[model samples]
Target chain A: MTMRSLTGTGMTEDGMDELLAQFLVEAPELAQQLAEALLALERMPGPGQALDAAFRHAHTLKGSVQLFDLPPLAGLLHAAEDLLGALRAGDRAPDAAALDALMAAAGAVEGWIMGLARDGAGIGLPAEAAALGARHEAALRALLDGPAVPAAAEPAAALAWLPALLAEAADPLAEARSGSQPVTALHYRPAADCFFLGDDPFGLLRRLPGLIALRVTPRAAWDLESFDPFACNLDFAALSTAAPEALRQHMRFVADQVEWAGVAAAEPPASPTVAATRDPGQRLLRVEAARIDGMMDMVAELVVAKTGLAGLAREAGGPATPLGRSLAARGAEIDRLVAGLHRAVLGLRLVPLAQAFRRLPRLARELSAQLGKPVALQIEGEEVEADKSVVDALAEPLLHLLRNALDHGVEPPEARRAAGKSEAGRITLSARRQGDQIQVTLEDDGAGLDTAKLRRVAGERGLLPPAELDALDEAAAMALIFRAGFSTAAAVTGISGRGVGMDAVRAAIEALGGRVSVASRPGQGTSFRLTLPRATVITRVVLLRLGEARFGVPIEAVAETLRLPEAAITRLAEGEAFVLRGRALPLLRLSDLLGLPAAPAGTERRILVTAGPAPCGIAVDGFAERLDVMLRPMGGLLAGLPGALGTALLGDGVVLVVLDLDELAGGAAAPLPEAALS
Target chain B: MSIALEDGRLRLAGDCGVEEAETFLSMLQQHPGLAVDLAEVAALHTALLQVLLAFRPPLAAAPGEPGLARLLLPLLGR
Candidate 1:
């Protein structure tokens, strides 16, 4: 039946679309979990929790897809659930063909979900899905009829090798044969260029949980003088008593390179016992990020209103009076409660970096294959938590960076070998929490930054004048890579030498109120470090007043607050400057910088020192109390304005325009006020 | 379906459906070196065939039915 006939019954088109979107986001994850569980069941067929999990995944998919009334898709999952139920009840054990059918059904459902996501809910299941459903139904019928004849046992050649290999490792194989657990014999012959694709045969072999025996042999005799270390010429055969699921999972990434079978001699365990452990309690709730962001905005508004209320209560009477004292006491209590509430809400927004890191290994593997460079990716500190917004925004930039590392940073195997390094290059992607910020660093051990080449390219591109380029130090010259249209590659390749440079990476991170930096040494390696805030819901700001309008500067950016007398300020040819601890700190007037009305300057003006590599002092008419305020990035026309970070509501109900100190300091080139020196 | 041990031969005849798979498998497992005679077999279910393939015993006589030979002989790589 057509999808429209099923889906358009009770729900509106918009409702269908919303549910489709949710299904698209959620169904694939469930389908993947189900696929893994089914593989586990195929390896160790028994009445157990694995079967239950597989059943639940299929059942959940059926229920969700049924919501949209996709008949074929839902029917496929239903058939799968029945097969699983039969397996769980000890009605039948799924042989190889049965497992294949189950996998095919799960895959068809996933494909339908993708189609729905791409074409909206109006899209119907393709004919292939119907065919797959029919196949699944047939398989289930056969299974229910009773255990079909198992496939022809292992091929004769494999059978012959099995005994010889077993004879070679008699003791362990004997022990393994005594157990009820099934034993899998695997023969893995990786691609000739598997090394280039970042396949670690040894590492994968070592991780087999119940390794019984392992043999590694050169596929052919090596010629001493003509040997190519870069090429993978090895064959690996292993016997592991590991659960079939574990073996399959370990080989999943390189499935094409391996052949595996369960030895017929290793029968199902005698008791066929189920695992005693129950499924772990699921503590996580899958909520849309936008909802959490909306809640955060509301909490910000409530905190502002609460602060306003406390201000009014304090103004109602002095602390000496009974009413004033009581209001003051209540206000303090509310302050504590609001702070606790704010923290609890902010905690909801934090997610682990692993969400983004998990997708990198595959990317590295694929890119390494494309570039013909073998790269070992080591990921560390994936458990570090950051704002969900930050994690979501990080994915694309991290992809670009990893692509760059694989393409440009990692040298070819021959080049690496010639340089006295291993033929396979290494890339390390690590994240760590330092104070309130998360530092994600990607380091590569290959050819480092060629500063001389970068400087030459920068000069040729006219990004900076020759004199300025000459004056730049090594670090500053290296920083030129972030300039737009900057590329140091001699020839453009499809992978990274596209016109888009590190400039885009920096721009994206900076847009998130974070900064990106690079450190590299010639002949060593390069590391890119991104420092981002742990959460974006609320920020501590130092409030300053210019004219009647108040503005908030992020407290992290404030170096020191001081009363700078007019006598101490000096006039420079460029603009106003002040000597703070023997360093010339550029001074900017906040009112002049933001193009706001200037309040009449009073003697001994308050100057807020902005901290960074280049510290700058901003003169304001007065200083207000510090606060933890919700900072929202400006929207609409104000979004284009320079030096405005976002807007925040204050205790007194005034909207504080938070300033972006980096932009303010960089753009302060207006003519100095001659009247200020008077 | 009938399975009998006669004259050191495991003889099978008639329809061997999935219900007879367990009995067929146990007989094959108990007598590791027994010869199989499928001369009078009518229909052989896949489950029973799977058990025969797993045991890999020597066949004493080819199936009387050409269709059974076509279905079962190549699987034994004869």
Candidate 2:
């Protein structure tokens, strides 16, 4: 079918873009809701309110699609609406075939929506959608004619007879077993109100891949005298040789209603697994990230202006005067309001880690299948929220870590058995909030890091000197795995071993003001922990003075500040050093680092100790009050300057340059002053 | 509006909908064992289907339309 143009729909190009953007954002959520409601309806089979809700969703989606001049998608949704409308109006009883048709329509619409997202609205509908639309129309017609084929005829009565069904499936199950396919028994008890959501449980059953045998029975005895046909009272048990992921995908919409177990050659295990139900009405709003960032910039500026106002209020009469007191009171009020505004804006950028965590299970499943290692993924604290930018940046690093775990950390089934562990290895991804930071840890219960091998690899790759490698402790040796060009993998695989795995993960995390650490036990497991700031808008910094200029250093980077007399300073071959509590720290003057005029003879100097793998002490003229400030990264001409974290405006209208200590400590070859050498 | 009761039998015609379900169910409740004749039922609504399934009265005659017969005959255990 030929696609219609936006112009023909009487929408301006910009307006069309706006509408399409909104549609792209909203259509997927609506489709998901419809699918969930439909699955619920199938389980329960006839809730009037659910039917109405399903109908409304279909109708609204159709209207939206039609407004964009997409006839095929609109038509598909329209057919679904007709079916749902019929059920809602009580003009047609809920039936499997009808629901199947509606499901097909919904799927077709979903495809079109995805297509629109990938290729613009100008893209034409595929032929499959046209076929689906035809089927939907036929199903609606059949429903209008009368009940369609007795709704696939409920399975023969008596759960006890399931043994017979198993016998019938024996041949196919045997074939699956012989072919080395995993066979599983599935028990599905849809929500009782599934019909109201427009779900047909039998229809879903019919679509199960690699199906071998099936039995259907009511959870409770039906009372013919007072039977409510609309209420679903059915339970389905089936044997299938489909991959677990396929089964999971098929039942994702109604996950809470399914119990599945691996079927062995012997009697099938009777373990019952219940799916977790997510609250349906969790409120969410989608706003453009750029808009939020814009608002944040404004808030930062407002904070700076408020600080300037407070300074002015102080200068007006000093706190002792009545005028000064009133000004101070109002200034305090504005400060509180601005603080609240800053928090609210920052919260707008917070997103749950589940956004990235949801994709890992599928990845683990696929990788395990490919590598011939059965790995089960366990996720926890997925609901922990972090900055959206951080979450987006996290996906790649996490993927790399998981791939590394699957390829090298996890052992094959036979090997795991020999090791006295379950044949199925486990990889767990968990997140937790600690203070103002979110820590995400990925751990695998498999062959842990071989520290000896790591040390040898590090030495072989020249990552560490031979003597240093010999003196490395277990933790220090494990840290060698993150060094660039160091890999312990005996043979490189496409998944993870070009000698560039953990280092990249560390780099990505550290780029977000976070840190990565590794801990492993020889035969037990290995874990990578990433701790990142919850948000990056406002930062706490310890203000410092260098000559007449002021600077700021992040509090996280500052381990402690010490007042050192001139006598405590010691000279090293490369630079100045200071002894604090028996430990000598390499010290660099802030004035020398930034090329500012040296401080005049000082009464006393303060040293700000920085923390990291290698600690350093930065000597400054004096320490100023530590305060919270919105740090904005330098733009344009100063954007790429090394050692500059960002700049923040002080209360007295001075711009305090925040130093990136990591970069400054690591980068010292630019220029040297003769005074520092002496 | 598309249904009428005559001679102790419920005769249904045209399209029966949710609007008609309560009255039909009340009628069936009032007169148990009443037979149903659907010679003219062009369409059946879910509410009416509920009434029929719950009441399960004997059908005076099978639905005239083959499509309709295919739907209702097995359901009625004919």
Reference interface contacts recovered per candidate: 0.00, 0.05
Q: After best superposition, candidate 2 residue A582: deviation in angstroms? A: 6.4
Estimate the TM-score of every prediction.
0.56, 0.55
Q: What is the TM-score of chain A alone in each candidate?
A: 0.61, 0.60
lDDT, model 1? 0.73
Off by over 4 Å in 1: A1-25, A31-291, A309-325, A462-476, A483-485, A490-493, A497-500, A544-550, A559-573, A578-584, A589-607, A619-625, A632-656, A667-678, B1-78
Worst 10 residues of 2 chain A by lDDT: A268-277
Model 1 over residues A1-678: C-alpha lDDT tens digits? 355664557778778767767787787767756765675565456555457778988999888878865667777777888888877666666666667778767666666776766665556777677776777667766666667334434234543344434434444554564454567888888787765675657556656678777655567765433434445666667788888898888789988878886765432111111110111237656787788878877788777766665566668775767887888788788878887888888789887776676457656756887888988776655557888778877887898899898888989999998999998898888777788899999999979998888889999998878887888898998898888789877788788877678988876677667889999988788999999877765778888877777788999899999898888888787778877886667788887788777777667778888887777888898888778788765656675566777788765667788888878776574423435444
Which 10 consecutive residues of model 1 chain A have the lowest summed lDDT?
A269-278
Instruction: For candidate 2, give the lDDT.
Output: 0.72
| Per-residue accuracy of model 1 over B1-78 as CA lDDT, tens digit each | 478888999898887655665676677767888899988887765445545655568898878988566445745556
What is the C-alpha lDDT profile of model 2 across A71-154, one tens digit per residue? 666766776787787776655777776666666566666666777666755665665766666766666556665553333333
DockQ (0 to 1) for model 2 = 0.05
